[model samples]
Target: MFCFLRKLHKMESTWPHSLQFLLFFSLLFSMAFSKSVIEPCNSSTSCNSLLSYLLPSDMKLAEISTKFNINPIELVGSNNLDQQTSQTLILSAKTTIKIPIQCPCINGIRQSVSTLYTVQPIDTIESICTGFGNLVSPDQIKAANDLDNSSSSLESGQSLKIPLPCTCFNNTDNGVTALYLSYVVREGDSLDSIAGAYGTTVTDLVGVNKLGSPSIDPGDILAIPISACSSANMNLYNDSLLVPNGGYALTAGNCIFCSCGPRNLSLHCVPSALSASCPNLQCKGNNLFIGDVEEELMGTGCNVTTCLYRGYVNHKVLSSLSNTYRAQCTSNHSNPLSPSLPPSSIGIPSVHVLPSLAPAAAAPFAGHGFGSGPTAVQIASSATVSTRTSNSAPFILVFLLALMLVFIPFDPNVYS
Candidate 1:
């Protein structure tokens, strides 16, 4: 090793000073594309976030869970996947899934410190970002970890920071609590189609984005508002217990979980089947669990008593009972596991985008940046960011041409 180092030093010394400077300058030039779309959040408020990740290749359920450092159960629950999702179950490529995020403020910016993507032998930064559906960008990832620009692909087994796009916007859009999904635009995607699939309208998409045109292409990141049923339970934790449409979320310190179906889209708080034990959840008198409901035959209808989840406070599970008369319990009670979803798959398949039926947008500020929830509207109006666009291309291209003219070799990954 010593002999090799000496020889390497000899070779490096033979290189001209201009060559070394050119190489260093080229690396710096590449970082010009390293603009991050991170939301600058310095608040103490909790930011519940989600990333829309498209599978770059086939991988087992456990593999993805490990990749993002999320529990397999939580992963499945977030995407409304079937309970069959296990560690070894393999998912197909091109499948898009939602990864729940508890985004925290790091160094005055809010992002997920987890979700580390290990470098694979065949992996490149471009493939990592673009192939995974632009939940992250090569520039963002590179800047996040101060990665080398010597090559596009790093050594296999190298772990890198994946700065996924997320938002809080006070966790509300307009006036309601919502789950903000940072959706990346793919080929053949249109505002109308995306809106229809997610139950959002074009007006909301445009209003949230402040986009003058609906034209989008692959690699562009957009904030998608999914209708969520947040716990009206006001807690000392200040948690809204927001669950995205057609998905489930474990909350209240993992003691209780809530679901909001694709249809109905109502809050359904239940004792978690996956939890080993939980605090007392039965509502007194009604003798029902956190999510239980009982009905009695009445004259022309049914008398109903429900054990409702109010909120968690001071480490205590809060429950309340409510009585009402209903003509019917509705068809949703047919089965808890199976719910009527749209044409696409919900669990273990491509999850549908749940749209916002609320007011079309935020109090119009402005931004072309990627952010989540009501904060996205604020990010759009405030930040001076443009990452996955032609905005910085000409500068990079001109610099690259200058390097070529001077016969300086640079990594091809610089543009990403």
Candidate 2:
């Protein structure tokens, strides 16, 4: 410690004031690196999950949605915003948002496969690490990118691989379709408080994580379960899905889109009128298209038949017809038959990692059906934003060091 103090004294005299500040700040902050969130994946069944993203700068919802390849509607609804919230609205920097992704076991770990970050001139490895709310580790980033100690500077425009935290514990929890979110534990966050915010129970959480005790620490990643409006996809190409209760999923090679609502836990699938050319979506002899419905009142109630999206097969859309009770007009059905629940232990498809459990039960969700977009849910934010911060830490340390360098003379003789 004394030798380091003497080195600081020498640098203080030789370096100018500005250099002194920069050097001291970098040295102090770089000493302590943040820990990575921990959740392992060993299951074959894949499911949807959420990644808590801290915005690096002011950005529009549409741009972010496009960057993540998600429907604008799902992005808005996931944040508990109005379905009609303009895509161009600029959200502030430092605001944390949940990003839904498919988490499958990749080489023994559960993580979404392909999230990339482009280097900027002003970005140091430390800044990039903090930009992700410290959920990402500097060492992980360096290991993934094969980077050296020169993190203070980097070649602009180079892409960096981000190994995000996520899970898919068989996509069901306590016998219902679920979405799992990788939530980082925070200080002052009791287990019950975390459970209550997302409308789940502490027992379910403890069981899902296979914990021996209820104790948790900051930076630990817990697989949080969220009940989803279930999917009954026929597994046409391994693209099975179950959307988080207010979110949307684009499937069938973008020819079909699905959304889930709080009304009865059904997945509403439809022909997305986006520029992609879809296969013939007509219900033969029924004068209907995917998501289209026809209703006739029976003696006691209503008899409804609708066209549904099953899955994409051989580049052809697989759809079927149902003659069941009046389904909330899809323009979608079914609390999908439950997959055999895996033993509770561990954990996306944003395809939902966590939910505000659901939205308030509303009118039978008569959806946009064709082009405008799916209905939004008034569900609350499911993942908790991390409370860790250190923007002023470097400055504070540098200030204190400056005082020590001048006022406290180093005793080289005593050290010798």
Candidate 3:
């Protein structure tokens, strides 16, 4: 009886140990299965058989959806804390995220936002568009922007507007359909040269032409899209562009360190100072600012008023610029930068500095003769004289008729 009781006690002890072993194996199996299904999430909450992970830099919603065997919208919406809400999210390398056990929202899903990007070196249109979350297809990008689907190369510094996948699913169909315009290739035209000229990508031209070679012959007409022109074809020195100071560097269609020029000054197109096509110093656009200064000189005691007017003419030309140079120049006041001259000798053109040697009535047009043209007041006077002559001529005629009737005989009898 004692031996049998001892055996039973040993068996009971082994049973407790056996139970612990089973529990340990069960937990291990569960962890292994979970690892296969979901990525490891850092949050402490026990996984309800689901997993989550930090997004890789190259990961996109479309790609992630395919990999996880779930809907792209569903996966992105739930996993994205910052993206789910409209609030800004800072996603640095070490940011932690919680992967929910169940999908959060039923009806709504994350959408994509369109983006604009500039082309960089060694970039292909196909690679660039696809690399950025497959937001824009090569065919769609080509079609929307009027690029040739044949080539897929891009030039450095050319900007492209890309559609991005974000929570906001802007029905991209509502966006403007871009058109591609064609330009005849001129002499010395390369694919890159043409792209630069039209502000398009070489890949676009290659896609359009289906050209295997980079060498482009003159007279090869290329199709370019309006977006390319609008975003990429920025010219800082275009005659139409305003130049503020003597020099300006244009980047992304905006000017830096520049000022506005006179309105009427004719802009001369020139090669870009920074770019290959940027205008030289002799180009009309280059002189836009200097021409403005020259015009303002007329108002500020300089005798030049015929300069062109742009947006900033009135401010620079009409108002006297505060003299930067306090010391006077020459006894005759010819040179602008002479030192030894007196404060009284410091002269501006015809402004307050120069007293009129001529009479007050003829003060403005004094040296200027009649053939040169009438002064502003003279022109006004001529207009008044013409109006009075028109009004008094009729009265004079009637008065002359009355005098004739008084002096001469009446002719009524002859008519009868």
Candidate 4:
């Protein structure tokens, strides 16, 4: 002890004063932040089975679960510990316990390799599962960790296995035949919007999600059904199947609108009549012409919205009047569009005749007749307007040239 003390005193004397202070703080920091060593298993078998753990001082199952993201109840169940044992505020130091390894899922399938996690000070099963996009459920963690009760909390410095949600299918199940996607709900999201975005309906979403009610809370994970009941034709709108009972066709002047039927089984469409009073009618149905363009209809017995054709207007007349128009259709199925022939085309030029300026104006004689020509004053005014236009042409050209010079980049080196 005298020799050690003498060596320390010699080293302190040799070291700079600042270096001694830095060394003391560094040692203190290391001691303060030091952690216990928790070894992982070597193979899948060992990972699935119980591994040895050394309990740190004053740590409980609750702290272990939070720190490691393990279900505390599972920890107790794995060791066959009594429920009363978990209530103890502190566990003895150096207590040996067995920890189960949790296997994570990849693309909805479990991986062969198990992952080991150390319990953190603030870890919880819900938080951990949420980190994985809610792919892991609390029940899954409990079962994997062998937790007997859901109320058990975790202790810091405890080890846990995180079992991921994955399953192997034998290709015989109904779910294997169809493709599914997982969607996490966000704030202000309703079943209507979610279903509409995915080309599905609330009924279909409820059935797929196994939801007892239409209400869904934020952060709820949903499984979306994306598989087509029957192969959809690429030529159709939205790559959807056209059912004969509920199918839609483009008519020469009819405005077509389609919706994805329940469960995405078929595409249903309804047509509305054209009108001139409507705004922006010209832009609508520009690609379509006067003839029924039909595709092979598939699937049947689907509920479709029945639409009525109010009347048809001449395409040329409608285009000249407005750039767009809203095709009005009522959802009342009882007032369906008449399957009768559409009205005759009303050309713009043939609609009306302009009135003469004079009162009691007589109709102009179709046959040739002598009429007065332009007067001197009118001719002189025309000449003056023509001269002004001719004179302004050069100035307009010069102004355009100046604008070009301003906008176009000029390279002096290129001229050189």
Residue-pair clashes per candidate, as listed? 12, 16, 39, 29
> Once superposed on the true structure, which residue ranges of model 3 sit more than 4 Å away at CA?
1-113, 164-416
RMSD of each: 12.3, 12.9, 40.6, 36.6
Q: Report the Cα lDDT for candidate 2.
A: 0.58
Name the candidate, 1 or 3, with the larger lDDT value: 1
- Candidates in order have lDDT scores of 0.61, 0.58, 0.30, 0.37
Q: Best to worst by lDDT, what's the order?
A: 1, 2, 4, 3
TM-score of 3: 0.18
Error at 303, model 2, angstroms: 3.9
Best-performing candidate as measured by TM-score: 1
lDDT of 3: 0.30
Backbone clashes counted, model 2? 16
- C-alpha displacement of 344 in model 2, angstroms? 44
TM-score of 4: 0.25
TM-score of 1: 0.65
Q: Give the per-residue lDDT digits (tens) of candidate 3, residues 68-103.
A: 344433333233221223122333322222121221
Evaluated with lDDT, which candidate comes out highest?
Answer: 1
Q: Once model 4 is optimally superposed onto the true structure by TM-score, how far is the C-alpha of residue 54 displaced, in angstroms?
A: 35
Q: Rank the candidates by TM-score, best first.
A: 1, 2, 4, 3
Off by over 4 Å in 4: 1-118, 137-139, 148-177, 228-416
